[model samples]
Target: MGEDADVATSLADSVSEEIADRLAPVDAELARRYPGEPPTRQPVHTVYVPADAVSSGTVSAWGEQAREMLDEHAPDAVSFASVLGLPSHLAGPVHDRVRAKLEREPVEDLRIDFEDGYGRRPDSEEDAAAARAARLVADAFEDGSAPPCMGIRMKCMEADVRDRGIRTLDIFLTGLVDAGGLPGGLVLTLPKVSHPEQVAAMARLCGEFETARGLPEGRIGFEIQIETTQSILGPDGRATVALMIDAAGGRATSLHYGTFDYSAACGVSAEYQAMDHPVADHAKAVMQAAAAGTGVRLSDGSTNIVPSGRREQVHDAWRHHHALVRRSLARAYYQGWDMHPGHLPTRYAAVYAFYREGMERAAARLAAYTGNAGGDAAVMDEPATARALSNYLLRGLDCGALSSGEVARHSGLTRADLDALAGRATEAQVNSGP
Candidate 1:
């Protein structure tokens, strides 16, 4: 009986080795295609300003205006929570964090729009504006006043505007290179992309620019705007977004939804166009699925509803924007676009409340799963679930929704531990252990 068992074990080992040898190519392909989520902090929202309107103080001005709105409408935690439908427990922390966030870092990501927002201009005028944008952004970074991420959104690759778009990109990048160097947080956006070929062209353009400027081969990456229906699906009846990502040749950093443009393309009436409409949901779902593990982040579209006018109107706008933000968060679209300064308070309010409301439960689950605390959790979690929990807490910390001290106290894990469990730690760091 012992001899038979030994023979069976030997055969099993040989079969396992053979299977691994056969799957080596598959393993390599998976690693190349899906490198997992990046460890860098992703801003909760991207604030877009027209290139003509963007000045050195644009970010700070937006912050001040947002603060003013809060002061006038939702001055206190109770009132703020009442407006947003936040629970009593979350009111104080969420409100305070939102205020501090506006003061410290109101806009995490800022995009100077040169596309639809700027419209068409004379060649000389556009050239100067692009150059001026580069100068302002470079100066902001040098003075430590820039948002964590900042860049320009060039026009689409359509036939009529292709040359103009290329010229603008070249001028902007050349200006950046001349002004010392490209900022570390430099971001680019290619709007109204409808074909994988266009995405490939963008990749080639970025590569050529890198070669010309003497930057690293893949140092520049841009977001792909999924606005047209063609970008979601091709005439061939297949998902084009996945192909677009592949065509980017590792230069696609994110996929940003273009709300009104997409809705209009789908023939939705102006009044029916919204981020929560069924059509919008379908498009974003495809985006979410395609971008899942590609190291490519997803951003939700914006609402055109600006808060202005009478006190009642401003309050109503705030409530509507706050609800939309919360809805996006619930659907796991962590980042979104903010079109107006008045959207900032509600943006922060929704984000803070979402994270704070769930922080304790996520921390507890992570702690129990990691064996860092006593007792078994009511819900048993697998490794994937543990990773999700750790990532949730890490995101909360990154966006200022939760403090490091509070997370540590609740989870019995430090930032290092969370990074390790979240698969963000380097080989050396993981091997060194806590």
Candidate 2:
């Protein structure tokens, strides 16, 4: 029996080595494609504030207006607040209500835009606007009102706008550094990328900026906007998403879907231009394929619909935002873009509802599955399944939909367990060793 066991072990080792050799290159190629560290607190949405409107207190200001819309249209405090993980039985104080929580960090990210949001301005005015935006960012940092994530969306890197884009970026970063220092959590957004070369140019520019500005190497990361059909379909007739990512040279931090531009580029009609449009989905799929496990976050485009003062108009807008947000959430695109301050109510409402509605069932199944208990068929949680399950709850916690203690209680996980699961679920970001 001992002799037979030794022979079997020897044969198994030999076969394993052969199999590894066959698959080794595939793994190496995948590693080369996706390489970097994903941001842990990726915002669920980026609220674009015009360069002129950016200020240290912009988030709080917009949120107050947003919450008032809440009081007007969504007046059912108990029902609305419950969506944010506030217990129905324990509802008491007014401050602990839904309106207050939404105001707390209403905008997870703020993109001071120098492109469409700022529109065409005189060159001098544009440069001044960039400088002012940097000052406001500095003030926001000093006041402790800065969002967890913040960035500036420069104009497209095309020939006509390339000079202006670099000008704005140069002024913004210079002002930011001179004011005090570049505040932490800063990222640059490169919009309307038509080709992979455009992406590579942005990477090279970022590297130059970092060295000139005395910032650390790899400190200034930029997200590519996948907005055109050409961006996904290279000029050579192949899918260019992976190439675009590779061209970033490891500075590719995130991929943001641009619905309207992409749809228009594909010749889709304006009537059907939307986040749920099929073309938008195709671009998003390409982005996910190229950037998944690459430490690059994916954000869905915003619905243009905005909440109006009129009662009739408000409902339609709320419904539209909610549906779009739910679609993104279902697709695992947790972060998205919010066009208006009024979109806040439904943004949280949809996210909170999505997570809370399924909390109990998911918690029970996870517990049963992880413990190997004889539960329903749903209790069969594999590693990927467990990772996704934990990720769902973690997002709720991050977005204020679920309280830490509550998820721990419901999911049978301690705080440590929850943290461990978040890391496990997101470890896909690191394809290369430190």
Candidate 3:
């Protein structure tokens, strides 16, 4: 409206464009090399059980198994314990709470394995086992006995194992199709991936499988296991994790860590190949950085120390497993693998403790920053903070750690306000990882 104001506006616009032009190259590189932010419902843990062991009613079976474990170890909640480090006085009550959760809600996702869990078998036996496993999964789907998510973990594409892997997958899929149409929320795990070509090959096969079965295109997605050092950093000196996802032809849904194998690949000794070792941390951090905000879920490797029958060994074993799970949660890896039914207690204990320990603090911080009527507003919330808050509540709710009412009450927000934040999370791109 005024001469001086018009001149100032024009100068500001010109300067802004000049700066933006200089930054264009950096912006382009980011978009080209990384994944755009996407919303995901990440499970707390995937229980990897042997194929020969899986049945349609495995969830109920595991629940019963977990109950037996609690009876033996934490009977009457008085002897209750895990790696949670709760005081002796409070251990019993905490143990009962976690036990109730495990029995009511066992595994989040189940991976019927033909990989490491089921070592190579004779062709006949393997083929028969594959068919049987598929039928079992089909039964699970029909009976609604399946967990929230379920899938198969196929062997890698290495030349030595490729034929066997493909054969088993073929037989299994055929059996599943004949039993029933494929279920939703199914994923295939491709392990020991060291090269992009392997990922591309898996992607190509997924396409062919969907076509052959008359399923929607790209309905089948796969998760790659960063088990090899080569997957962390390839020959090109770039992050191989990124390349492998690219090779998946847009069908990559998640990336999983293989603790022992990755540590072994890094030249660590066998006994020292634990999940939270510094070397393991480096690998996991690389994964988080590469896949963050892209919605390609990240899962930590499992703690192999499944507690034994002996009472003396149980405490130490439980403590170790608990610490590892806690460390993984702290690193923003909400999911990991539970290799044994006995691990259910420790895994859930760690998860519940992690959430409850910080729930009030996180809620207060979020409420204070949101500037609601009761909020302090002393600390302004940024886009990333808001995203983290949404992700935190979403994760807690997903895993059944916090009820809807609890989250709403603590965060000082209504259901509609929470929904708006979740909407913003889906559209925003920022790494909210701690």
Candidate 4:
């Protein structure tokens, strides 16, 4: 038995060596792709929170919750108010309700609903309703009583509706500027962006609008709604969240996850698992990739499963959904939508957890770099280490964890490293040894 065991061990070792020899080139190639101690990790400090859609006269339903959450959590992005309670076919009531809400809390950003505020048909009535909604929100901004940030959710820029959507956005933005109600910034929330060209077209129109209005070029940005499976893993399999921003040429401020729509698109089974399933993963992957180096923020789609029944169930549901969000954040997401107020703590927790992870991961990466080379020796490029370094710098900027100088100091690499890596540094640079 002892002789047989020894022979087996000898054969296994020989096979392992042979396999390593065959794989060595691949490992080297991968290593070449990732070099050096990864860029230092930085904690994500600021987080944005956008209020999901709701009905008229119901901003208060979520406003109080927002106020409390903001006070306790102090989220960096806050779109805490919206206009609600209007019927699908009426523009007047919808506009008026929004006006009331703005009067109450000085809404940061106002959303214009198509199916809800305007009728399905692009008739005079629907057009009027959309115009009215745009006018009011613009008025609030021009009057100096509006929130510093402002945006609108417009219909998809599909070939069929492209003309209409562009017309509506143009009218709204033109109204805001002409009425002296233009807010700090304008975001065109485009639903179902299937191609980069779609975003580019919107950008071009925005430029045209800027020229017409005498507004500076690049004054507008896009917030793409990643609600379709195609946007995540279709023929354009690499559709990432960052690509959404890049399509706008540094103008995209955020990427919003469209949960319900995305679920429907992906045909998610076990409907309740939308937030945690493969569909959500692809959606988030897109968003996270878009957000990686761009200053643009990415928001997870809304958790449609609302709070329910017994006190504990409500709390548990919220926590469960929020936990999913926290997971997203830990994986480097910075924003997500909250359909209900109870999800507040979960959002806050996600932010805190991300920061904590950033701090720890960054400190450890830095420590590893220093320890590997006796504290003063420069680090070499190793794939894992390189990725860490690159990610550290990029994520650091996103998280506000490290300044350029500090990053240089810790990594012994300059802003040039940051810039070069950010520009086209390959994944091969991600794993260089220290």
The clash count for each model shown is: 0, 0, 0, 50
Span of 10 residues, lowest total lDDT, candidate 4: 77-86
Off by over 4 Å in 2: 1-39, 78-97, 372-378, 422-434
Best by TM-score: 1
Q: How many Å off is the CA of 292 in candidate 3?
A: 1.1
* Per-model TM values vs. the true structure: 0.95, 0.87, 0.87, 0.58
lDDT of every model, 2 decimals: 0.91, 0.78, 0.78, 0.54
Runs off by more than 4 Å, candidate 3:
1-7, 11-40, 76-83, 87-96, 376-378, 414-416, 422-434
**1-434 in candidate 3: lDDT tens per residue?**
76667442436677989999999999886665554444546788888888887777778788788777767766654455433466665465457667777777787899999999998989999899888888887887787777878878988999999999988888888887888777765768999999999999988888999899898787678899999999999776999998887788778889999999999989999889988888888888889988875558888988778888686577677777888888888878889988777788878877876776666666666777676555546667776777677667767766767677876677787544654565534323323432
Best by lDDT: 1
What global local distance difference test value does model 1 have? 0.91
Pull out the clashing pairs in model 3: none
Q: Look at candidate 2 and give me any clashing residue pairs.
A: none
Q: Which ten residues in a row have the lowest lDDT in candidate 1?
A: 425-434
C-alpha root-mean-square deviation, candidate 2: 4.0
lDDT string for model 4 (165-211, tens) is 77667776776777774565445677878777787887788788888
Model 2 weakest 10-residue run by lDDT: 89-98
